[model samples]
Structure formats: structure tokens, C-alpha cells
Target: MQIYPAFHIDKKITDAADEALRKAQPALKRIDEVTDYNQQKMLAAFIHCGVSESHFAASTGYGYGDRGREVLDQVYAQALGAEDALVRYNFVSGTHALTVALFGVLRPGDTMLCVTGLPYDTLQSVIGLTGDGNGSLKEYGIHYRQVDLKKDGTPDYEAIEHAVQPDTKMVYIQRSRGYSLRPSLFVEDIEKIAAIAKRRAPNCIVMVDNCYGEFVQKEEPVAHGADLMAGSLIKNPGGGVAPTGGYIAGRKDLVESCSYRLTTPGTGREIGCTLGNNRELFMGAFHAPHVTGEALKTAVFTSALFEELGYAVTPRWDEPRADIIQAVLLRTREALIAFCQGIQKGSPVDSFVLPEPWGMPGYDCQVIMAAGTFTLGASVELSADAPLRAPWAVWMQGGLNFHSARLGSMLAAQSMLEKGFLG
Candidate 1:
């Protein structure tokens, strides 16, 4: 039966979606289990922190002794299994939070090692991988080095061990797959890397760009040995409700150092004002695990449906997932555009808009994006984006609910079919 009577979806596509749902049952069930565990963890943190109506009250200028801000940090720290956390609406993005951690921990003579190869496009300039060194880590005199991933797109453990130096102050790991075809790093992988780095240099900090990986698994990177981790609130912890912010959680000392960087060296985390954002931030954190589960189900369904349609999908439907991203190799420019446009069409907001490829800043080439979310640029709200380059693939993620996400995936297929991009 055609489930979406309001829109046109080919019978073949509908049938494929049904079969895909069937194939995704096991994976969906696992997502539910993880969601339950994470939800419980979040609940415990809230209750233990004594989160109440008072903590939701806003603060103003200098925000001296803001109870909500302070308790927000405690709640996040407890939830992520970290010694401390810095949660702030001032953090413009996940990259900003990571930058604070990097600058806060490393000195001019120190070295930073990346075990996950090159980072996301937005981080290229920050790390001086692209563009002039200007204000990047490179310009600040801190040495940066990367050990490329192996041929199979997995971390090169041997290379990482050899790469760590006596002067290495930080070992970086990006938990998400980014724009690459590599697998997302799980907490177990983080544990091994942390162990290896600490063994080589006892003082080295293992930092994870936890971005899209938050709440997707039963445990976070901090629980498995990461000394520090950072992520954007808009992505996962936002629960599709947090207006804007980011978080950094990990070792107490390291988190303290990051706080200094986030504000001023002397003031640190003590003075940030929550203004009118405390309630939504708290509410969002409370709902994150469940929202993340919905996104995971959407990703699994996408993988299964795309596979049924003969496209290659990473972490195929039944495979274990470490993040919400679902990469589908459309293999052609037209198909990619069609898929993104279709996703836009299925969005609750701005459904009539058409997305086009443009030279977005912080990227090497033209990139296309489709996001009609309530929150701008929220990847946790069913958005598809891809760089216009070789091996064209669309990275899709986020869906507040499974039903809406499933319909979006089917609409993507329908668009491709109408354009004859699908066989």
C-alpha cells in the first residue's frame, strides 16, 4: 500500500522502502537499546544534578554566579562520563569548541598528532591544512602532523604508535566519517588509541571531535578513555530544539584549560551568561538520546533502501553504526542533485525550495546542501549535503522522527527515478 497518499512515489520505490524496513529491523532494534541506555544515563545526570525550574532561569551580563550555567555543565559532564564539561551558547560551532580545547592545551613548542588523517573541510583552515597559515594552529608555532588512514579506510594503528612523540601534547581523533568513505570511530577504537598514545607519551591528551557521534552509541568517547571531546549542540545534543551552542567534556584539568580559552584566562567558565537559553538547552539535552535514536533509524532505513535500489551504502543496513551519517554513492552529479532536492521536497519547512551546488566557504570545491530544518544547518534534522567532486556521494543524516525520515528517503529515490538517474 502507498503510505504517503499526499505525494507521488513510484510503486517500485514504495515496495523497495518496505523491503528495506524489513531488512533494517535488527539494526533498528539495536538502536532502540542504545537509546534506552543513553536516555537513562541522561535522566540520571539530570536528577543527580538537581535540575529544577530554578536552573532554567536566565542570566545577564558577566553572568556572575549563574546557577543554570554551572548546573548545565555539571549535568553534561555527568551524562558524558567526563570529569568536567563546558557548555556554552557562545560556542558558535563544534569547530570553535575544538579550537578552544586545542589552543588551551598546546603550547608553541608542543606537537599535535592526528590519527584520523585529514579532518573535515571546515577544519582545514583551522589546522592550516589549506589556505594561508594566517591564524591557524600552524601560524601559532604549534607543530601539526597526521597519519593517514590505511587502504581499507581504517586507522593505521602502527602508524599512530610510531607518530606519537615525546613533545606530542595532543592526539586528535575525528569520530565521524566526515566527507570521506572511512568508517566512524567507535568508543572501542578511541580506547585503543588513547591507550596507545598514553603509553607512548604519558602526558599526551587524547581529544576526539565527537560531533555527530554523540548519543549514537551506548557509551561516549570519554567513557572509553578520551581525555577530551567536543561537539556542536545543533547536531545531536540539541535534540532539534537547542537554538545554538557547543560542548566540551573530559578530564577536569583539561576542561578547565578549555574554559579559560572559551572565555578569558582569569574568568573561565564562571561568568558566562545563559541569558534566555538555559531552559531549551536543558530540555534539548533531556531529549537528545531519543532524538538521536530517531536519526539512527533513519540512517539505517536509508542504507537499506539505497542498497535495495542498487546503490552502495556505507555501514550497510545491518552493520553496527557509530554515528548517524548515511553515505550513499550516487555516482553521478545529476543523481546527487536529485536526491538532495527530493530531501528538500520532503522537508517540513521550505519544501518548495530547490538546492543547488555553490562554492561554500571552508571547502575546496563547490558543495550542494539540502536542509529545510527548523534549526538552520541542523544535520540532526534530516539534511543531505555533498561536495561536488569525484565519486559523488550524498551524506544524509538527522530526522526528528523515523516516519518523516523514511518518507524523505523514499522521496529522494522518487526524485532520482523521475530524473532517470535510477535504473
Candidate 2:
């Protein structure tokens, strides 16, 4: 029984995006010519699971020789404008890459100012404020300070400037809201932060945690003067190709240092150079631009649909998108739970598993995840979560394949409607 009417899309939005695609046909055709379909299919399968061609290569010990590195270099140059880039199947997650970058660049006694307040939930332990003390950065003796976001979710630049100390070695800005329901920082905002870092601590490095936010915006953090930008292979950049890994891109020196940390202290990027899942990484990067664009469109569609149903959506249609995430404020725990259950039932993961609020490892409050089957925040599938906060705001993240995202959103709305959540 469908409780809500079928989704009615605004033809204007779709028409405009279609026109833009048509205008960019030359570039699209070029991308099509360079991309290998066999590799793209394999990459897509790998992203859906936890395995890929890279996993097979590594297991068989058929290393990613110099040729693989060369391919990576060419790929980075074409896609990210990075002079040098390293893609390893061993990074495991975005946080792992961030750890490598932080350890590689900041030495003991150096200070790291968290300009974005407490980063994503998982990073809390890594930055030394929480957990059982097994994380990096803080374990390496790096000090940390935070500058909280203002009422509207933007960073307080004055507070950030005030937090900079004489020994500040780096400033970290996470573009994605992570577990927080706040909106992501924009490129202009990042530029402002960079400006403040340069003026306050001239020698300090400015790094961005560019996870789910990748490719969503035209201007990357690196383009706006970020010393380094880090993200996980399973997120936006993987584009459905990388089986398991992470990436770090930035200035030549900083990337080189990260390579050293990734391998051994003395061994540089060239050292421990094993051929990673080149096929997946390469194919993923190739498809990233298209996949990301589709995901953004799905997000826009979901936002508009939810808003029409009377749910409060962040960043209305007239506003610019912060990231691909589309948050719908449910306003009550019962409604939130119903919405999540609907999403879970509609997901590609376990459809029978019902989500409930439970105390997650690092978070301060009980949290609920509706279809995040891959241990952490795996965007390869659709999922929704809500921190157990008052007013019960639910945060919906991801839309791996837009088709699945659209169906799941409709089901979610239907579920809510059945529960009398809608007018």
C-alpha cells in the first residue's frame, strides 16, 4: 500500500541538468573514450562489496610495479591537478589516510588546531580527546585545539585565529559534516580559513578532510590553497572502483612526507611501492565525475521530495548544496525510527535488520544506522542515521546508485505516511 503519492519531479531541474550535460558533451565523450567498460563494471562490483581486482593482485603478490605508480600519477594529473599523488589499497579508510598525513607532517610537540571543531565521530579518538588512546596524532605528541562552529554551522574565524598558538604546525578542516547534522563548509569558507591560517601562523599547514564532499563542488581544497586533502577510497573519490584504500593529494612536499609515513620513515613514496588495485582505482577515478554528479542530483531530488511532504530539509532548493547528503528533520523519535526502517528495508544490504538507537563506540550519545553494512560510513549503499538528540533530527546520508536511492526515499516516505508522520 503506497501511503504517499508517486514522486513528482520538477521538470525544470531535470531539463536544466540535461542541458548542462549536453553542453558538456565533448568532455563527456572524451571521458567515455578514455574509460574502459570492463574495468568500470569490475570497479562497480568491487565498491558494492569489500573486494576488488586490487585485493586479488595484493593477495597473489603481483605488486603494482613502477607502471602502476606511473598510471596513478597520470590519473591524478588528469583528474585532480595534483603534481604527485599516491593511491594505495592498504589505507583502509579516510581516517587512516589522515593518520598517515598527520604523522608524516607533524612531529612531536607540534600543535594542530581543529578549525572545524571536533571532526567526524571516528576522528575524536585519533585527535586525542577520546577513546582508549590507541589513535595517532595525539599519540605522536601533537597538541590539539578546537574552534567551534557558529549558530548557522559556519566556523568562527575569530575563534580560529585566537586558537592559533606559536607552535601550531597544522590546521585541520573537515568539509563533510560527518556524524554531525551541520552543513558542510563551502570552498569560499575554506579559502577564508586558509587566509586566516596564513595570517595568524604563517608557517602552519592547512589540511582538509575531503571525504563525501569530493567532486560535489567545482573547486577542490587543493585549488583553494589547502596544503593537503585526504579522503577514503570507499567514499566519493572511489567512484565505485576502489575495493579498499584511501588517497592523499596536495603539495609535492606534503604528499612526499605522507608517502614516507605510509611506507617507512626513511622509505619515500617510491619505497614499499606495491602495485595496488590499479584497475579498480583507475576505473573508479574515471567514473567518479559522472557518478558524483548523479548522486548530487539524487540528493537534490530527495531534498525537494521530502520538503514537499512537509519535512524540514536543509539547504532548500534555492540554496547551494553543501555536500551530497540530504538531511530531513523528522522531529520525533518514532518518525525517525520509521523512516530508518523504511530505508533499511529498501537497501541492498540486509533488508531484515531493524535499526535501533544503540551506544556506538566513539560517539557521545546513542546512534542509529539504517543500512550501513560496511562497518563505517560506506557510501557504496544507501543509509540513514540520527544522533539521539532532542527534537530527534534524522540525518540521511548516501545514494550509491541513484536508482536505489530514489526507490529507497520513496519507500521511506511511504513508511512515514503509514505511521501518520505526514499530513
Candidate 3:
């Protein structure tokens, strides 16, 4: 006998979801094709690097001559089409990896230009835009400037060309949309930005924040022209398995510099220990492409469902996706809360817990989040979150598998309907 009662999904929501799936067919096919190509690529990387069972062994303090650690880096470098890479659990977050890259390449008198306009909120403190100036880029005497995106939310190529200067040591590109409504950048966009940066400032390094953008398409930023890139492992690349980590991949010399920043200058990538996390990390890399495809499908389904329910959504069901994130504009605080609560309810873990808005450390506004992931804050699993502000948009990403993700999205809509937030 079944131990638990079957959960109810309203007929209205189910009907809407069925319609949304019909509309999402084309996008789903594209995702499958990309997944196949990326899977082959990842397999090639593993074979090329000669990944073996012995490579999964752990090392302790000092960790000298750790073969597994070295091979892990090689596999990532091959997979990302980078000359070198630093993959470590020690880096903590995507922001930390980005910070290391920034401090590694820049000097006291150098300037860093952001072509994607102001970055996400968490980066503000690192760039010295918010918080006390302690250890920020500005405090270290690195100048910062940005060329805002065009009114249509595309990069201002001409403006970027003009903005590059002799002292511009790094050109920053953010691949994900962050909390904004603008479209996330594609690898082609990164290539163009890199070409412009190299043309205007030959010595400048083109760096990309690749979070949420990996394995979505056939090519990564490094393959297209970016000199360096960084991301959190807990996102798409983690395959929802890696407990904690981040990666920086790029030109060999630049990667070495980042390694220096990650550890002490003399120690660099040579010293850190894996502490038995190697197996999960390697397994995560192997499964990343498929998991990312699942997330993309879920995002598309959510987009179509919300659109069917008469709400605005970014990168509609049939649109080409650059990342897994799906943004739904609820337009009211009550609806936003209800949608998030619904997502929490549908979660496999902590289904009964009610999520509320609170002052999250990185953001300027009170943020509400619902994540019942096995690994806390793992965005590769089904999750939804939003800041309490105007337009009331909730950014949803990750679905380890499409079936569960679709149900979670439906529950969100059902919650809104139950509360009369939907017509």
C-alpha cells in the first residue's frame, strides 16, 4: 500500500502545464541536441585527461604532488577549452572565484572595465561599490568603469570600443543576467566583446563570470575568445552532486595568477588538498551536461506555463536559452510570496516549511528563497527566489530532472490560483 496520500494538483494548473509543454516542444528538442553534443565533449575531456579511479583518491595537509588534484584541473581545462584551470572546493562561491581572478590579473595602477554595466549585487562589495572599502578593488587602487547596455538590453559595442583605455587591465563580462530582466549574454557576445577589448587594449584580459551559463550551449566563453572565466560548482557544473566548490579557467598564465590568489603566491595550485571530495567532483563533471539540459527544459516549461497564465516571463518557451534561469514577473508581493511558497511545497525535502523574506547578506533588499536541495543553496536542484521590490520578479533555476521540476512549477501556479492571485 502507498504510505503517503497523493498530493493534489489542480485541474486548472495541470491544463495550463499541458498547454505549456506543447508550446515548449521546439525548445526541448534544441536542449536535447545540445546535451548530446556537450556529453560527447565532456567524455572526450575525460578520456584526453586519462581520468582513472586512482584520480579519485584524497590527500591531506600540504597535499604535495597530488595526482588527482592535478588531473581534475586538466579535465576541466579540456572540457572548457581552456589552456589551464583551477578547480577547488576551497574557493567557497562563484563570487570568490571571480574576486580571485580580478585581484590576480590587476595591479594597483590598473583599471577594470565592466562591459555589462553594473554587476549583480553581491559583486558590489567586492568592487567597492557597496560596503566598507576594506580589501575591495577600489581600496587596492584599481579603477573601475562600466558602459551600460543599450536601451534594448544588448551590449553597446561602439561604447565598449570607446571605453577601453591604455590602463584597462581587465574587461569583465557577466554571462548570466543576474537579477535583471535583460537577456543573458551568449558565447558569441563574449567573443565580440573580447575582440573589441583586444583591439582597443591589447594587454587587457577578457574575463567572464560564467555562472549559470555552462553546458547550456555547445561552446563556452573561453572557446569563443574570453581570456579567462569563473563559476560556482554548486550551479550547473556541479550536476547537483558537488557539495561545494568553484572553478577558474583561462590562459595558462592567467590561471596561474588566479591560483596564486587562491592560495599564497608561492603555493598556488600546487598545494591545496581535495580531502576526499574528488569522486563527487569528477562525477559532477561527467553528469553536468545532462543535468544542465534538464534545468533548461524546466526553465522553458515554467516560462510557457506562466505565459499561459497571463504573466510576463523572460526568454519565453520557444526562445533560445543562454542559461537555465527562468524569471516570472508576478507583479504583486502576495503573488510572488505564494509562488515561492508553492515551489517550497513541491520540494522533495522540507515540503511543509514556509519561506519568508528576510535580509540576505549580499542583497540590498529583503530576499525570499525556497530551496529544498540535498546540498544547501545548490541551484542545480529545483529552487526559486526573489527580492521584495518592484515588478516582483522571481528568478527560478535548476531541476535535476525535468519531471519533478515541471511538477514544482505547476505547484507554484496552483498556489497562486488557490490564493486568488490568478484570475
Candidate 3: misplaced stretches above 4 Å?
Answer: 1-5
Mind giving the per-residue lDDT tens digits that candidate 2 earns over 130-154?
8777756678788888888988788
Q: How much is 311 displaced in model 2, in angstroms? A: 1.5
Candidate closer to the true structure by TM-score (higher is better), 1 or 2: 1
List the global CA lDDT of all models. Answer: 0.93, 0.71, 0.92
- Expressed as tens digits, the lDDT of each residue in 1-423 for candidate 1 is 358479889989989998999878988999999999999999999999999999888899899989999999999999888999999988999899989899989888788899999998888898888898899999999888999999998989999989998768999999999999999999999999999999999988999999999998888999998999999999999899998899999999999998888889989998877888999999999999999999999999999999999999998999999999999999999999999999999999999999999999888899999999998998899999999997999999999999888899999999999999887
Model 1 bad stretches (over 4 Å): none
Model 3 lDDT on a 0 to 1 scale = 0.92
By lDDT rank, best first, the candidates go 1, 3, 2
lDDT of 3 by residue, 1-423 (tens): 111247687777778888889878988999999999999999999998899999999999988998999999999998888999999988789999999999998989888899998898999999999999899999999989999999888899999999998668889999999888999999999999999999888888999999999999998999998999999999998888899999999999999998888889989999988899999999999999999999999999999999999999998888898999999999999999999999999898998999999999989999999998888999999999989998899999999999888889988998999999888
How high is each candidate's TM-score?
0.99, 0.82, 0.98
| Better structure of 2 and 3 per TM-score | 3
| Winner of 1 and 2 under lDDT | 1
Give the Cα error of residue 95 in candidate 1, in Å.
0.8
